[model samples]
Target: MKYQFPENFWWGSAASGPQTEGAADVDGRKPSIWDYWYEIEPGRFFNGVGPKNTSNFYYQYKEDIALMKETGHNSFRTSIQWSRLIPDGIGEVNPKAVEFYNNVIDEMLKQGVEPFMNLYHFDMPLSMQEKGGFESREVIEAYVTFAETCFKLFGDRVKYWFTFNEPIVPVEAGYLYDMHYPNVVDFKRAAQVAFGTTLAHAKAVKAYHALNLDGKIGIILNLTPSYPRSQNPADLRAAHIADLFFNRSFLDPVTRGEFPSDLVEILRERDFLPNYEPEDLEIIKENTVDILGVNYYQPRRVKAKENMPHPDAPFMPEHLFDNYEMPFRKMNPYRGWEIYEQAIYDIAINLRDNYGNIPFFISENGMGVEGEERYRNSDGFIEDTYRIEFIESHLKWLHKAIAEGANCHGYHLWTFMDCWSWANAYKNRYGFVEVNLDENYKRTVKASGKWFKTLTSQNGF
Candidate 1:
């Protein structure tokens, strides 16, 4: 039951700009899509706690980097708000935003904690969304410009760069599901948005390598392994379809420089294929990532849809494949996601063999538990045994994958400080360090925090 990581393995945590930074309208920072969406649809978020009231890490990053070091992080991944850099998403670089980010990045370097910075994480400058967000090819060009600016500004010191974080989710939540901003349920627009994003990522990667930046660049994708109900051919094929849409849609394009034939065929069959140019394929092929970040939280258990709806029903992803809960599968009640640790190994090995063994990291994986305070002891520590088990179980599998020649270099959990989820808000906590919501930002290291420190120091739990 014991496991050890490679001697130089990276132990860290990951967070996004909008998720943690709270000064929504300060320091010459313009509103992002999250801020704009919350103002109009306050009811959309859980408990009405929008992006403005997260962890206050914007002003407390120095204190936070200290906490990261304390939690055994030699490296930490966070993002720079694009709106802060370009208030209008096009021209006029904001000096205050630059100054604030310089301070944060410098502080991270000072503490010997490598800062893996991402350019965008579901937070588009509100100005760009007005011009049709990813729908407009003009928006794609603007993103490349913003990306180049970031590299010129921070590429000297910060090495690790991610172009986007889970790009597919927005296309689903915003365009298809109506759960995120610019909510619209249209397949055509969703397909267009997804293609634009793929092109945008390729363009950014192209730009990064042109600048000849100091470090590696990659995309952070949420790759959930899809499982079939049984060996039945129908169930197996259904799982394959789900994986193509959710996992390979972005994965294949970015890592392999080509989209899957199965997915393209589906889109073609339904007349949902997005517009594409000949030059785009060359860009994607030439500018593939030097690294990858795989965010695995749970596995998808799928079965064929029980009933075929009328062909006219609005097409959602769920229409393609139905979710069926296995009678005996383990579950995380608070989070509503299944627990399948071995899937991590499956992901690692699959990438190794299929994606040419690109260097990768566990980008985002965590347990979100409600009312975590109940476990806090009088001595000011939370006995998060569940978190420890969840992590160890996954690592056991990850170790096996590494031994089998998977090119995994690191593991960064969902977050360091307790923060707000888009819809869940602060209702569920996933931080190793707990943040006090009622009072000033006071942080206490939970049992998981202490446990992680030990794991990193010893290179194992």
Candidate 2:
């Protein structure tokens, strides 16, 4: 094979609890922020569909895992819902949730698939959210407890664990912007939320290490390389600041065990410092992730801002930089995100050169195209030629990175099947298997799925 991956490289896809599991009101599962937000305003969701109207993984996990095997998934990643596991996110463990999760794990293992479990995936229990979610110390403690419970319960069977998936999304969506629940546009609150989540991650890693479980714990971070529009000093500075806020804020503290000094200085100057205890810094410093999960989808290209922000306006990350769109750049027009496959290689090199060459994987990377159904071919499967090309291009760059000594171990797509997103709902589909919502959520393997089977069977394309 011209492009073969390392032996034992992970091959599969990822999906979160809230996005895939549809039993929003069953089996001792309480309301997550998504569920509660949907109840309050259903129209905010796509076609008025809520989390309850997902792919129904709660009932069809067995069938889905079988499909995963058929699609050449030697390993798979999914999150155990905090609300389902602990109805209140803090107290007694639900026996039903334990049974359900154990069954899922066993089934995957039975089908020769390694189960990678993530503790949290942006599904904060409403009870916890009522108490300020990640913005409050109480919530942070509750999250740490949740992580510990998961470790104690499933650590033996599930050897791979992640504390959180894209923890920065909540900071950006809920605190910085109004895309998610408890939407408050406050930079100070965003900082606090981000700080608390990272601390929670470190605390969870500490707890996992205490258990001495034969597993690795880490965090999934979306690393979008910040590209400057020009070589000008101001433009470079703008990109640097953007990276500081979005990438280094979580990457440094989680992996390097320290927040970026440049970012801390800016936060201090603006009085936007998070309310962190002195001991919390020590916890973060002492406990860093064992592995890293890099999720790359798009790059952030920015130019220096042409106009200064008005003093009266609320603080925003974009105030310092203007988004730049390079001419002749490939684009994912369906999602309105640029498609720069080379950014994946850059991320691998950056991690290898600067982050101690830590073992990592492509945790979440896939193309989300709208109107995928229109591509259904004579074989009754979506052709998805573009999706196949997207994966192949990214994998080519990934192979190049691996050849150069990047310690990336695997490539998992964004999802196992198309499922609900937070606000976008089912607007964009990113899956190897196309899920038919109208036909009792029937699963059909797309052309990409067939290609992936061959890729994994041969260890690469």
For TM-score, the strongest prediction is 2
Choose the strongest candidate by lDDT: 2
lDDT (CA) per prediction: 0.90, 0.93
Off by over 4 Å in 2: none
**Model 1, stretches more than 4 Å misplaced?**
none
lDDT of 2 by residue, 89-130 (tens): 888999999999999999999999999999888899999999
Model 1: residue 204 alpha-carbon error in angstroms: 0.7
- Per-candidate TM-scores read 0.98, 0.99
What TM-score does structure 2 among the candidates reach? 0.99
Model 1 quality (TM-score): 0.98
